[model samples]
Target: MGTGTGRMASVLRGACMVGTMVLLAACTRHGHEGYARYRTNCGICHHGGEGMKGEIPPVSGRVDKIASTPEGKQYLMHVLLNGLNGPLQIDGVRYNFSMPPFRAHLSDEEIASILTYLATRGDTRPAPVFRAADVAAERAHPMTTTMVAEERRRLDAIHPLP
Candidate 1:
């Protein structure tokens, strides 16, 4: 083969390799197939109604307001791991919802992937990537029941639940 042709072939091969790697990484980290894990578990109550009165707020667009800030993201992650049942105010709307914690139900990596999926597709906020390390650290320092009660009191102080 001519030197020029050989160089061109090498370039094409390199480009093809890069493209394939990118596609594989994307498939592994995102899109429809990426949702299989969450759908099987969290989608149970998060997607819609359960008729439990004050249980399971739809996890779709409702997370937008909270997911916009780091504190909010932390709060959501904490709640998912710790479970919160009481009053929650989102964008001035009160939701008397109770969320069952998933600490025991899911591994840190699994929870992180679920959070990433929700942040990516469900909310308008910037995609929130919950790394397994973050999950582990957060799980290690869980929000105590007392802390949750205090948080509620503080929120109520600011915006009384109706």
Candidate 2:
């Protein structure tokens, strides 16, 4: 009986150590508060920024470019706050899904963080960090998803994808 109990204790310790390592790795991979917020709020569709190619546009590499310009920055803020309904063509691929509005659920700070995370990942160019103030300003003048889409169209005309 003593031998069996000792073996069981050893196995339990080993299992505990493995669990701890897994938890630590997960935390390391998703250490930023913005990354956590993004996983909870946007990852379902965006898939941790990889996106669903041909359906949802990838936010990682591409968002940095879009967030570089003034009007483009405003467009991002509007899209996050108002959500977008589309028939939108990104890089010649048309995505016809609707992105649900997060204005009611997320605060300006959280939205800013998520956008910052999206804009910074896997990018070489120096992009401006999105601030809570920027989001708050956009929130002051609420636009519908349709309006956001129109703004996207205008921006697209000026900066067509390569």
Candidate 3:
């Protein structure tokens, strides 16, 4: 740990921090915050939409179908605001994991943006875009994570994803 080595390390760290800030700022300025937020918050676990060997579900097809309907839209928004747990099955695959709620971590617009991002990730016919108000309405009447799971079940029964 010579002085030169320490100084070089510090300089590298500072450069990395500054670069990250600039990248984040660009996303905000360019209206790519949804993609940025998803990468920062959800990408690790979901592997950027590819599930981790079935422990997680890809945020594609099924969610797109869900977001397309009114009840399904509300349910998805609730899941976003309150979070969801698993022992859940989707499209014949079983996934067991806990999804922490983002009610506090994200603003209404941010949540809508994430949802909109997910909804358009694939070639989902009639991709539905989310409004911040859609998220705000769900945020107002907060549902429990457990309640969200129940709603998922009801939604599954009524609108079972293909």
- Number of backbone collisions per candidate: 0, 0, 0
Model 3 quality (TM-score): 0.77
Cα-based lDDT for every prediction: 0.66, 0.83, 0.83
Candidate 2's C-alpha runs over 4 A off are 1-31
C-alpha RMSD for every candidate: 4.9, 9.9, 12.2
User: Model 3: runs farther than 4 Å from truth?
Assistant: 1-31
lDDT of 2 by residue, 1-162 (tens): 699999999999999999999998854553386788999999999997878867887787776788888887888889899999988887777788899999999999899888877776846456557889999999999999998989888888898632
TM per candidate comes to 0.68, 0.77, 0.77
lDDT of 1 by residue, 40-151 (tens): 7777766531223345455655444455656666666786788777565544545676566788888887877777766666546456666778788889977764475566
**What lDDT score goes with residue 145 in model 3?**
85
- Residue pairs in candidate 3 whose N, alpha carbon or C atoms collide under 3 angstroms: none
Q: Which ten residues in a row have the lowest lDDT in candidate 2?
A: 120-129
